[model samples]
Target: MHLDACTIYRYSSYFIRVFTHIYWKSAEPCLILQKNPTRPIALDLQDIHKSYGSLEVLKGVSLTAYDGDVISILGSSGSGKSTLLRCINLLENPNHGRILIGNEELMLKPAKSGELQAADVKQLESLRARVGFVFQNFNLWPHKTILQNIIEGPTQVLKIKKRPSDRCRKIARSRPTSKKKDAYPANLSGGQRQRVAIARALAMQPQVLLFDEPTSALDPELVNEVLAVMRELAEEGRTMLIVTHEMRFAREVSSKVVFLHQGVVEEIGTPEQVFDNPTSERVKDFMASHRPT
Candidate 1:
């Protein structure tokens, strides 16, 4: 797929500055944040609510995730963090709300039969398909090789042909810095397995990538590898949203850090703004008490 050349070039230049800054004081980890009111919003969620039986997980919530935003949603377990993500993807429908992705209308609270058009579903599904998801557990197929796992989603779901030489293609695209050429999931380390899972997500040619605790399942030592890969993706300027507990990674990599409390967006702002001077006690308490494990 062809990307915007100018945008891609800027993305590369930004990374160059990042590495150059590491070597000298010439460049200092520049983060050019934009709160441009004119930029089109990428995602819009309004009056979102989810309930399971007697339990109400998400109260009415509204937020906008804008273009070129790399956001991290941090909250304790049972805070409706994952469920909110599910609602975004339509994996779990919101009780009452409208989710607009670009120009398409996604979620529906079930209007009268003739009230909602069937074409809305198609438009929304197409939109969802463009967004890739990385699960907490590396959900790679045990039967397929690493290369096979990477290309299978594009082949099966997107109806693209899987090349016989896809193993080489995967390596070329991933540019694996390590030497595990033809390894399977069982033979690969936790980090490598997660990398394969990530490669699979990228092979689908997604516009936005959503990571749900991508490194939570890995051991402490292996966590850095997965985080490093994510950092590289951010450098590539891929629009991404992540739900994670890694505060250091959040501070280092994300443009916007959102503190979700009780399913509501308590605070959302730049990492330094939120980290250095949090306005909400809920967020300050949450940050003060929880250290990376």
Candidate 2:
């Protein structure tokens, strides 16, 4: 019952690590969702390719999103859904491709192994700011309180002042704020953490928001809470790219649905076209397997 300071510290450290593991998984994945492009094109990916050694993950994958476009990239595991999203946000550079945001294209230089990279760090940072990304596991910092996490990007990266973020206020209104605004991630539930993650992305005021399996990490009961927030955003006409297995959500929310097979765009069209009548054998087979009971 009476533990030494060292023993208490060790237990605390172990609990933090274990809790973080349970709540936040690895952070990289691909999902391209577009909102109303303030410009002609919000986010464009041209013939993107990514390979790990000889195994090519993304092969000639091209995506184009315009104003008010909610495109869902759907596919089975290993179909390169996540890889595609990673490339767009530059989390993982594509072996070869061109990424354009608005009227400006990303400047890149050839890196080793035929890959491409941002010509300069400043350019990459600038581009990332315009594109918001929400990971499956809410990547909120365990040490920082909810408010601190939400405002970090705006103040640090975008050089925004300490003025309150709209998103933070929105989230705060959802629940009674008995805890300090600085309440750590450990104090929040899965759905709350994911909401904070969304707020963090929205605070940047991204032109296009990318969600990589946003609801996959939540408990079945918690999934709807996160999805509701996303739905509200979609209703507000935010451009979103979601890579998910939530077929119903995709069909209901997205204007266009893209099916990727073996790293290539297999089928793409309006949800009705892709879901109701899939042309490709690969898509037909995939849908058949995933059809709800």
Candidate 3:
């Protein structure tokens, strides 16, 4: 059977839209509206621990981020900085811990393997949507246009209508990658792609943002573009947990700095305390090594 180009295009578009609608609808029960909590804590992790086989990655890590706080997680390689970040959203479930977002606690049940898993999958899904994660490597969908990528979560997961979703896409794009809405990810520069990724996360209107070394994969020259966006977010008082090696940026932008050593928090305090007058010998040595000549 011979089909015209228009006919094939129409069929493909219809199927894509229908599939998206149906898939999201199946998860609709898990999508609950968030209520305003009196508590100001945006995120709280208590006594979190993680291990891979015999190697423990995180050891009894606890941190709290009040609303609008920018907390920078710093450590050398294998200090579990990224692992601790991942555990907050359960990208990597911890062996033991408690996590609270706002006033709502993430219910967890122990598994046979002694790992903790989400007790209520629906609730977990609902809470996870409120946390936005930005990766070191830009995780954009190669086939989707930038606009499509930004609007997808709102339109599909949140079931937002076209008009409001369009507004969100515009707001998200306003700060980052405004010129490349029609371009695909492959067409943009590495910095542009990371900016687009940030825009996509912003479109969700998340309560908190987690950046796992967002600029680590970029070239030295391109790093500033992404950092500039993050700096603007900090200035706007966005609650963020950033795992980064950019010591100067952390010192300048973070409300608090946490230095992790050997899977434990070696030191945590204001940027001044951690960077200038750290009491921990390990942290002092680490700071000295990172200090600019």
- Candidate 3 ranges beyond 4 A from true positions: 1-39, 163-179
Clashing pairs in 3: none
Model 2 lDDT per residue over 45-73, tens place: 99999999999999999998886678889
lDDT over C-alpha atoms for residue 96 of model 1: 71
Candidate 1 lDDT over 1-293, as tens digits, reads: 53332222223332222111122222233363465557667777888888776677888777676677788888888888888887787777667777777656664546453122233666666776677788888888888776567656656666654353434444334443224434578888777787777777776666778898988999988887677777767766667789999987787778788888887888888888777788999888888887433
**Candidate 3 positional error at 79, Å:** 0.4
Error of 3 at 128 (Å): 1.2
Residue-pair clashes per prediction, in order, are: 0, 12, 0
Off by over 4 Å in 2: 1-39, 162-180
Give the poorly placed runs of model 1, Cα more than 4 Å off. Answer: 1-32, 107-121, 162-181, 291-293
Which of 2 and 3 is the better model by lDDT? 3
Query: lDDT per model, in order?
Result: 0.69, 0.75, 0.77
What would the per-residue lDDT of candidate 3 be over residues 1-293, giving only the tens digit for each residue?
A: 44322222233222122111111112111111122245388999999999998999999999988887888999999999999989887899899999998889999999888889999998988888899899998788999987677667766666654454345344445433345556798887788788778877776668999999999999988887687777767767688999999988888778888999999999998887899999999999999999732
lDDT, residue 6, candidate 2: 23
The true-structure Cα RMSD of candidate 1 reads 5.8
